[model samples]
Target: MLNKKKELYVAVAVGLIALGGAAVFASQSSSGDNAAKDKKPPASLTSVTISDQQATHIEVVPVKTYDFVEQNEAVGYIDFNQDATVQVFTPYQGRIRQVFVKAGDDVRKGQALFSVDSPDLVTAESTLISTAGLTKLTTAALERAKKMLETQTAAQKDVDQATADQQTADANFRAARDAVRIFGKSDADIDRLLQTRKVDGELTVNSPLTGKVTARNAAPGLLTQPGNAPAPVTVSDLSTVWMVASVSETDLPRMKMGQSVSVAVMAYPGKIFQGKVNNIGIAIDPATHRVGVRSEIKDPEHLLHPQMLATYRIRVADPVQSAAAPLNALVREGDGTMTAYVTKDGRTFTRRAVQTGLEQEGNRQILSGLQPGEKIAADGAIFLSNMLSLQSR
Candidate 1:
């Protein structure tokens, strides 16, 4: 009975091992079948058939070699023409008496922008008064010495010394007058001040250009000096604006001065601002390796503002020979490959992978994998791609 039991146990162990092997084989076969079902067709083999009604909606165009201008794209911002932007600073140190203009106020050249009560002006007036007094005294002394010399009561040396003193006094008087003039006072005003001996100690600031006041920092009783931050006022002439863009090193050769440029800002969609290249920087940025290009755009309506984000398109090529298709016909696949659908017959569209170059003005350049005379699906390329994706599944 013990021998028979050992033989039966060995037989059961062998049966169990066979069953496990069969199970693994069956699982692998099932996985292989699934993988076959999931495999996708090659791009060229993918095709789609649409009804006549669907065909009516699709646009078709022939790939052709075009002699058209190539456009290069860059991003940049709008800036005030620095040549027309001015920061106003007062030459005299003083306390602000009044502000005549506010931000955004249109001002003319020589218009008063603000007024200040400056002790510096008072000091200048006092100096002028003292110098005039000394001048008068010296003149009288010189006359007395001349008369004495003529009558032989004083020596010629005394008359000569007195003449020198008068000359020195005259120079001091003129310098004092100039010191007041530097504060924007007129000669007539200085003459009146000397006669009246009354000083106003008030200085008014004027605009240097005909522009809109962009900033104001003055207030009553606030002390101000030259070179202060947030300058007393800022004036900007907005008749013209600058659009600055960054061009990559690779695209630098295509850029040239006086080339026409089109600028678009988010604030105004569908509107293209016209401009021309004014300058291109020779130095490349160490951090970005990009060169700067500046375009001068006329803003007659003052619609553009400083620091506004803008898009720039510059025409680099002039009627160059190249192969291209309408931008609508290009499709981007899931594998990051660019493709376009071509057709030998109207009913069947074959997808072709293409290497692409620059895209501009509603057209894209095909570097390879496309012929000049081939017909492509221009409007419904995306729809065909979507249908092919569904059929593969």
Candidate 2:
């Protein structure tokens, strides 16, 4: 009875174990099927859809006809015309007593700038005084000798000797008077020195031309001498200014005298100044391989100055037919090349390499690789480029 009871219990335990194992295997199989189904790519991500309006957000431009002026670009500098610059130099050795003018001062012609204490001027004055005194003596002696000769109270040789002495004295007086004049002394001052026998050490320095003082090299009490460094003053007339441009030889033929040009300085951006080509060089510089072109600008208000850097654009007289597009149409490729997209149809964009010209009046000129009346991608070019890149990938 006990063995039969144990056998029944074992059978029940085996049956329960078999059922539990079967249920566990079935659950794992169902989980594997679910995982396999989930492994497939999701339906929502299988494709990308973009609306026509969203695609159109990539802005576009149209090629249009415009009148483009051909221009030659060159870097240039502002300079005083050679005819307008004057270098003032000392005429003699002297000590500067006072300087009345500073650099950048506007002065008129013959305006006194400073005074000099000059020993040469004193010597000139003394010589003039001595010569004038001798002149009076010689004149009296000549008159007496002439009278004696007329009255037959003197010999012919005596009258001739007295006349020769008078002439020598007269020549000496004239030479001394001229010497004083050459020393920059006025005639009235020379006469005063002769009458008073007193020397005036003050020598006035005057401007030779009507212009502004551009340089000051001497100070009060400094010695000014000839053959030394230049005088303390430099003057220039700024009413008319010159712009010097170095143009390539290839562009030389396009330039002509009296042609209108434009100039801009970095100091004043977006402000263009107008000028006329006044001169052109016949020869090219061997080192730079460029020709010098000079333009003259009228500055009545004296706004322009010397040595300022400027950019010049010379207008060529050639008739130009140009194609233009909006600024947004420009695309920079990875290799530093520029490209633009032309829409063959309203929906398709074709990339084209374009050569660009000068940008003027907010529009850029298309030199080549584009036709007028074509539609171009004016904005969101980067998005278009990325799309193309993705398509290629």
Candidate 3:
């Protein structure tokens, strides 16, 4: 929007040209005294009088106070909210066995995205199977030894030795089961593996957060290691996003963190993404004298996309309470002055010169020449000004 400032001024100039207003006043001279006396309209240069019937065609509105805030704009692009964006990689060293999700796919927390064949997990499961067999065999031997001792066949030392071996085997089995659990196995999975004596090495990787997958680097047979990048996949929570722009360093003084911002992008015309200023750059660019301004925008609907050309307006000052006039009530004069037709009654309107601040919400802020409760011509103001100009000329 800031980039269109020049266009806005040109548009206003065109509008004024289209409306040829009355001359400020008629010039009187000795040579044209008779002509002026012969054909003078019943109106002064800054005032006009119309019939009652003509008043109905013109719209009149009262001036009132409106709250207005000053805002500055910066242009930038949309990006993922980095705080919620994450790189997904394998938790252990392995070869990817399956890729369940592709880029741009939505996933839920704990949902599986891929599986990998982890050699470490397979080794742990294999040890668990071996320990289970040794534990069972030792248990049977210890039972036999106890029975023999009771029958006066085995000595106490022999029974004790068998009991010690059984305990050691059981401890080894428990440790092996724990090692497999580290590979993201449940107790139920361990039990099933033990029952079938099957050693499965495939370890599934689940999404750490509920979001959309933005990038996928994992594929079948791809080798992966913990903390390696280009990550297996990139998932990001797009509930919020960043709008970063480099604005003039001079504007930095008025801008600060936590200021409210309204963003517009080319992708979505007329839709505003509301956000707040989250950061202001400390360093300034020596070439451009600009600093980075970042805002966090809420995108609960997820309509925003990364890299979209975005421009945001941030309020730089507190709102000012001032008299506001409807767009139709203010007219641009031929001499480049803004004028409003002030009326004491419906039929008589005085052309009062006005100073305007900013135009917003279909109203032109009345910086001067009008006050609250004053009535002015809100529509067809040009007709009055033109009629007076024609007769004066």
- Summed backbone clashes in each candidate are 0, 1, 1
Clashes of 1: 0
Q: Which candidate is the best by TM-score?
A: 3
Evaluate residue 230 in candidate 2 and report its C-alpha lDDT on the 0 to 100 scale.
74
Q: Put down candidate 3 lDDT per residue, 1-393, tens digits, no spaces.
A: 876998999999987766634222233354378776788556547778898889989988899999988999889999999999989887789999999999999999989999999988889999999999999999999999999999999999999999999999999999998988887789999999999988899998889899999999998999999998789999999999999999998788899889999999888887888999999999999999999999999999999999999988999889999999998888888899999999978788888999999876687888889999998998779998887777666
Task: Give candidate 3 regions above 4 Å deviation.
Answer: 1-44, 49-60, 131-178, 343-348, 382-384
Scanning candidate 3 in windows of ten residues, the lowest lDDT window is 20-29
Candidate 1 local lDDT, 1-393, one digit each (tens): 999999999999999999999999999999999999999665544778877888887788999886666688899999988899999988978888989999999999999988888899999989999999999999999999999999999999999999999999999999999999988888999999999988879998899999999888888888889888778999999988999999998899989999999999999987888999999999999999999999998888889999999998998867667789999899999999999998866668888999988775677888898989999999989998998888776
Report, for every candidate in turn, its global Cα lDDT versus the true structure.
0.90, 0.82, 0.90
For model 2, residues 51-163, the per-residue Cα lDDT tens digits are 48856687666798677787888898999877888777667789999998999899999898878898988887777788888888988888898899899998888878888
TM-score of 1: 0.63
The 10 consecutive residues of candidate 1 with the worst lDDT sum are: 40-49
lDDT for 293 in candidate 3 is 91
State TM-scores per candidate. 0.63, 0.63, 0.75
